[model samples]
Target: MSRNAKINTLLLVLVAALAVLPLAFGLGDHKEEPFTGADAEAETAITEIDPDYEPWFSPLYEPPSGEIESALFALQAAVGAGVLTYYFGLRRGRRQGEARALARLRAEADADAGDEAASERRRV
Candidate 1:
């Protein structure tokens, strides 16, 4: 193998070894200890919550029933489809406008060339 290739391989290996060495050696002496009185108190407080409190859902405005849930899903899908369709339509219209502008410029250039040719012919 070439010297450069050997050097690159050695560098890559060195980086990988360096990266792993810290992670391997950084697992420094972990010694487990029993939880203290404060830890026990905190655990107890968490477990002692009032049972009567109503749970809060992730999304608060979720529909409760089958029909309502289906309607909400359908509404969301329709809105998404509408937005996509509008965006695609706008993009398509812009492309069409650009094509029209290019065609108009080409036609004007052709017309100007024709006029220039006619004027040259008259001068002769």
Candidate 2:
């Protein structure tokens, strides 16, 4: 109904389309392992280019299975999202509080000025 609501709805639709279009169209069907991570793709490319290539260092801690690795990645993403959400929410609350305080101060000042004017007229 409102302008902001319309905009937000449009944005949500666009995000959903972006997420769904690839899967709906089978974009990764050509790949042997579709939806693999960039790291795995990079490793495949490197090995293809140079058979003797070796990594400078291995991961300090590797997950026991792909499922565990994906779970850990999701957990990391969720934590990062939570931190960002908290930070932004705090900033917005502070800004709204400051704005309300400023409005209250202005209203008080205006009321004081009106009282002063009325008192001056009464005295005269």
Candidate 3:
């Protein structure tokens, strides 16, 4: 396999290991609600520290249920990923096109120079 393929395979394995190791070892078993978001944990800590604490602002829109909230978050993440991917893909394509155009121009210039040199020799 090529060097890039080998590196990609290794990265994929490392990512998979990172995701699986925590669950396999039951890392959050001590928690009442394992795998809860950091937001919830922060809220719990704040409430524990100060019972009278109140939020200065509220969310503009709250999902009716946890499932909906999760779905919305996933949707947001997917859209963001898509935007980034599109941007990078466009940049790569433009760069490749510019390189090809430059190569073509260089080849044409060399061919023109060769032809001019040959004609001058023939005239002499």
Candidate 4:
């Protein structure tokens, strides 16, 4: 395989290892609830540290179930990622377009200079 292919393969393998290693060894299996979000953990820690602590404000809409909540969280992440992807893609496309336009302008200028040079050669 080519060098790039080898590197890509190695990276994919590394990612697979990272994703599976935790599950294989049951890293969070000791917990009563596996894959709990940081918000739940933070709430637990705050309540333990100060039972009288109050939140500045509560969310206007809470999901009915953990599954729905997870779906909404995933949706939010996907939307944010899509926005970032679109913005970056647009920027890259504009840059490439500008580069192409510059190259075409240079080519046209070079052609015009070459024609002028040929005309001067004929006069001499």
Best of the candidates, lDDT: 3
List TM-scores for all candidates, in order. 0.47, 0.68, 0.69, 0.62
Q: Put the candidates in TM-score order, highest first.
A: 3, 2, 4, 1
Cα lDDT tens digits for candidate 2, 49-103: 9999988898898899989988999999999999999999999999999999999
For model 2, what is the error of residue 89's alpha carbon versus the real structure, in angstroms, after optimal superposition? 1.6
Q: In candidate 3, what residue range of length 10 has the lowest lDDT sum?
A: 31-40
Tens-digit lDDT string for candidate 3 (1-124): 9999999999999999999999999998998988888998999999999989999999998999989988999999999999999999999999999999999999999999999999999999
Off by over 4 Å in 4: 1-20, 42-59
Clashing pairs in 3: none
As for candidate 1, its clashing pairs are none
- The C-alpha lDDT values of all candidates are 0.82, 0.96, 0.96, 0.96
The per-candidate count of clashes, in order, stands at 0, 0, 0, 0
**What tens-digit string does per-residue lDDT give for candidate 4 at 1-124?**
9999999999999999999998899988999998787898999999999999989898998899989988999999999999999999999999999999999999999999999999999999
Candidate 1 Cα errors over 4 Å, as ranges:
1-65
Which of candidates 1 and 2 reaches a greater TM-score?
Answer: 2
Q: Which 10-residue window in model 2 sums to the lowest lDDT?
A: 33-42
Give per-residue CA lDDT, model 1, range 47-81, as digits (tens).
67854554365675768897998898899999999
> Model 1: which ten-residue window has the lowest total lDDT?
27-36
Candidate 3 vs 4: which has more TM-score: 3
